[model samples]
Target: MRVGIAGGGIAGLTLAWLLSESHEVVLLEERPRLGGNVKSVLTAADGGPCAIDLGVRETPVEVSPVWRHIAAAVGVSAGDLVATTASRVVLRKHERSPLWVSAADPTDTARPVTTGGPAYRAMARFADESARWETEGMSWDVTVGDVLDSWPLPSTAVRHLLCALPASLHGCTTDEVRSLSARAVGTTFTPPHTVPRTTYLRSGNSSLVHGLAAGARPARLLLGTGLRAVRRAGEGFELVDSAGAVHATDVVALALPADHALAALSGLAGAGAWRTALKAVEYREVTYVLHHDPYGMPENRRTWSAGNTTVDGNRSETTTWYGPSLGVDLFVSQLDHRAGRPREELARSSFRATLPTPQACRARQRLGAIHEGQRLLFLGHCTTPVETQEAAMASAVAVAQHLTPCGKRLRDYLEGG
Candidate 1:
């Protein structure tokens, strides 16, 4: 079979890499290079050149499986690829005592979630009910206010967990999100460990992209070619590029973001609801200031901590660090918006206010989209299972599984029916 993949990010590359052994694969990329958000740069630092990851700075072993697979495929050990890990997290706001957090696998015990606060236990109870609603094939697609009003939540912490984490991931306030979709994705992952050390790709995240691309080496790997349209062409699919050039393929995976895929495959009517769902979902933006400071050192805390800061009613700022001697990189979560703001200005402000000023700081900002189409098979920093390389890898693996048809029913085989 011949497979054509759209978007040359980790998902496209990983799919191509895994399927190349059995199928003829052609990977299409709109960007000039692979690794969409995984791009890294090596620039001149104070006295010498240092590598800085503009995107995907961390890969935690505790939760990320995509990096592990990529590392294994490329002959890189996960342990060796890790840059730094610290034992403590010191916060600017909570200076009295640092919270002890660890990622060691906690014993799983099915316990009742907490509730009991001024906000009323009704909210927590409602959330639990909404979760049950999803198992029964119902959706909680309403404002956060509506969700809380409809359910019985009893605790502040539970309400905070329900409200904040989803807001951060979905890039929307509780009022604008789907309670069912949000909870479904949120409850799927393992929580962060106290000592949350990020693993840096020594050669940058793009190294994995290049390795996957090299492994696939598709017949016609076109860069800077955007798909403008997709219509039926006999038994297969016809794809029109942005320049009016048309290409045909036996199997087509609308692997771009939910919106892009919807626009390209507009002729297909089967995707109406899927397209609406994909478009309805929202995404958060990520911004960072990358620089090296000589003075105003950050304590050797493992992961940067966020104080009690709020962005549009969301606590986004996590931590600031002064130590890089042990290979620690500064990371910030949650931002206001992804437009009009000057990158250098934001970097300067973040540098001046947080850690000591570095000789030079580089600001990198990226915006991701979240949508609802099921046919598009969208995978990026904004989708299921967290915004990490592991999601991309898992998506690729899932794609492979989907491409293959099943034979006898598993239950029949086991029961000999």
Candidate 2:
């Protein structure tokens, strides 16, 4: 079988790797490089040059078994997986003090407010209730705003915990976070009973991308080209690329973003439902700025945390990732149109993130209907409930299993058989 995978992101790369052993695979990427949202850069630091990740940085091993398993399967050594700590703080506009901070070591002088009085208590309550909502299977239509409004917590507490925090995480405005489905938020932010350790690729995510591509060795690797359209060709399909070249494949898998996938299939016959479902998944633009200044941090240095979220009026909330993990002074901030660019900015990149609004969530559920029993398949963020690296790889695993029989070794590792 010959398979043509579009969009050389994690999803498309992983799919090509999984099928390469048994089939002739061709991978196409619009960008010169792969890895999709997994981007890393080298920056000059005090000690030496350090690698700073601008996108898809860390993963919690407890929640991301697929990512952990695949990293090892691709020959990424254990030493390259570095365990790290994650601490977050929330601050109000122009305030030197943090409105809330996560619990930290008691002896750490930099920790602000050992106890977060009302806000901490409210957070506990919210976590408990959100977990219960998940256990009971909350409806897809229930918005986070709906749940937060029903709570008796103070408005400030609700705003900081539910609105600002998620806004920064999802790269959206507080108002936009409110319309997100409660189930989607709950699944992504389910407060664990115990703290979980997070890990990042010490060599940066680009290493993983290189490893997958090297191992896959696809029949044809086309970079700097994109899928223009998909058309029926006898019992297979003909993929027209932006360079006016045609590639025929027995199967087609779209690993591109929902909007891009829809546009690629615009010329295909009998694809109205597929186009509609893909179009229903909306996206918001997020800009990432890498700099040496504390653009989005709280005014106080003692209250600085690994992740700092600043909430101000009408402007979209911004989150700054402190550089202590990289042992550098660099910082990465997520900014929207309303925010100003960092003063000491070294580099900037922009991405279109899918908004997990109630409407978008419902649309995602219908995507499977369009792809089932069809030669064309949709994977990655367009199909997954949560936007995580693990989910993206899992989507590839599903497609690989559907298309071919899994070998015992790979099957045992993925399924714990």
C-alpha TM-scores of all predictions: 0.64, 0.92
The lDDT of each candidate is 0.48, 0.76
Task: Report model 2's TM-score to 2 decimal places.
Answer: 0.92
Regions of candidate 2 where Cα sits further than 4 Å from its true position:
105-110, 113-116, 190-196, 337-341, 369-373, 407-412, 415-417
Please provide, for model 1 over 279-367, each residue's C-alpha lDDT reduced to its tens digit, 9 standing for 90 to 100: 54333454544444411112433332321222233342332332332244333322344222323222321110110001000100001
Of the candidates shown, which would achieve the greatest lDDT relative to the real structure?
2
Backbone clash pairs for candidate 2 read none
Winning model by TM-score: 2
| Residue 66, model 2, lDDT | 79
